[model samples]
Target: MESNPAGQGPALSGNVMFYKKPEPLSPEAHGSLGVKRIDQPLGFLRSAHAVPVTVSEFGMAAASFPVIFVGNDKTPVAVMGIREGQNLFVGADGNSDQDFYLPAFVRRYPFVFASDNQSDRLLLCVDREGPMVTDQPEVPFFENGQPTKFTNDAIEFCKEFERQRRATMEFVKLVDSYGLFEQKSVNFTPRDQNGQEGPQQKIADYWAVSEEKLNQLPADKFQELRDNGAIGAIYAHILSLLNWQRVIQRALRTPPPGQPLS
Candidate 1:
């Protein structure tokens, strides 16, 4: 696709995770750049313990991992692991377990949409430093000075991701308006071979939708939520909290260094 040469267009600021050098896609700057297929395409996820998930992904993500709301924006994130710099779901070979649902956010690695503050346009940018990106052969980003089929596909995927992101924001606002969010924590207690419990250790602290508050909402308000088709995702989030133990179990299977495995 046609684009402003590297030095032009609005600069992408802010600290985006995983993207070290995200530059706007343009034939002039990246005509020779393309991605090479790698054995471990998902290796980047190895360091990501929590990944953002949109409302539409809640049901699918809930089935695989705990979905928790976090921060002032109440961004929904799937808990992939209990510790920092570790993802239990992602294997050393950069492959996730079979039959587990992977979030779209994780699947859209190396490509992201950044808004141009000068105008109401979103730019499709790629992580120039990404491992899969290269100056050599494979899938070409541009052909005959225009974006190729691969680039077009990435643009479409990024576009859909942006739509889902906005929808997720609205869902969060709706949940907040009803005062259904509550502070919560995940704790783990170690047990000896004899099954003797040790001190409870707090693994993480975050926010969650309160099932009691949701149940106590006025009939009209509850019906409104149902009509909006948000009730299922809300219930999914609550139910997904039960999977925190599953994450803990996974963590126990792959304990951190210096710790004995149970």
Candidate 2:
């Protein structure tokens, strides 16, 4: 078996490499919000596009609120909107007299929606996927634009979705901080060992062991292990999970409460 200078092996069979062509990075990529670029800021409101019928169906009525549409290099990733005044609230029947504050993150993408009407400003962050959603609880949703009541389980799912989104963002920041993808050279030789294969083989063995260990732990435990200086032992395992994508999708979905799809 041949080995690269870094002691890494050649492409293995059944290995699928998904490479995202580096986008033309902007200074915002390294901005305060983490690995995201805000090409535009809050300004003149654009003409309203087709509003999802689900908004009214869910009995979410708000006039002239700010909606932020988050996306990646592709299509719209998530939509978050916030409204103010005494009439905006999240009630069982989607009718109330309380001001509503809604912050959401798409589970499958690195996006977040933070809105406060008192401040009259909506803050949008990108590439900051985190565990905004998880297995703890469920959030309600409007079905077919009808104010049908949903179980707490539904609401919990929505919450978990956001939790997962934030978690993904944090994970990306962690990897970037390590500069793991930055190109570097490493040396490995079979002859270097006592008549054994080179560093590549050693790395492969280590990865195999690490993977097994990671698979056995639950999500929370796995994260704890990583926080406790077991990162290298579980890097490959966590990366394989692609947990970021899950959070992104969830964030993109229309959230419960009387908030519009911003």
Candidate 3:
């Protein structure tokens, strides 16, 4: 989930990788705001550096992106590109590459669940800048001064997402409790004309479960992690690191915003 540009901090409880202009959805302010369904609802995501993901998406998303953790609390994020302001998955035509798993974070765009820190209540929000948002939505958000089916569905989706987020938080806390997570980083190098490897370039840094520490856990702790389904997600993340090379290849084939493709 993207965060409010007002610097209210992370857009989502766990991750705030892509949110830029989040505004609370209100009946009075957005009464006429309707979202127009477009074939390319994700065009704006072309510029996203990275996106949040649910624990359920670990396996599928890991197959396509480098799943890593961010922030002091260790929020998990799918590495989309090796550089900032770039996303190799989005083509120059501004369309997400076909046949790829779409993370729930992006799929829930335009509408999101925001927490009112003071009230400790969850509120529905919309990205005023979202490309899918419009005054001419095929489905209106409000009808006769009341929320329509579209708004209702969005609320349901957001509510479910927030619930999943809480579950993910517990999982992260579980990993942290065991002290199994370690800071992770990667490097890249290109071969020179003569086949000599160039200077190693650092790609990105994040946290991940340490395989050694994970393996060294006590029986009870290990079982706890297993019962909670953290083991699979941890290994999935470890395996996804191999796909870093795959992302490198894609970056070479189609570069992101700042870095050009080879």
Against the reference, the lDDT scores of all candidates come to: 0.88, 0.27, 0.77
Give the higher-TM-score candidate: 2 or 3. 3
User: Model 2 — which ten-residue stretch has the worst lDDT?
Assistant: 16-25
lDDT of 1 by residue, 27-128 (tens): 988989999988998888888999999999999999989999989888999999987888899888889987788998977878888767777677888899
Ranking by TM-score: 1, 3, 2
Comparison by lDDT, 2 against 3, better one: 3
Mind sharing the TM-score for model 2? 0.22
Which candidate leads the pack in lDDT? 1
For each of the candidates, the C-alpha root-mean-square deviation to the true structure, in angstroms, is: 1.9, 24.9, 4.6
Between the candidate structures 1 and 3, which one is better when assessed by TM-score?
Answer: 1
Question: TM-score for all predictions?
Answer: 0.94, 0.22, 0.85
Local distance difference test, candidate 3: 0.77
For model 2, residues 101-129, the per-residue Cα lDDT tens digits are 22222111233223333444322222222
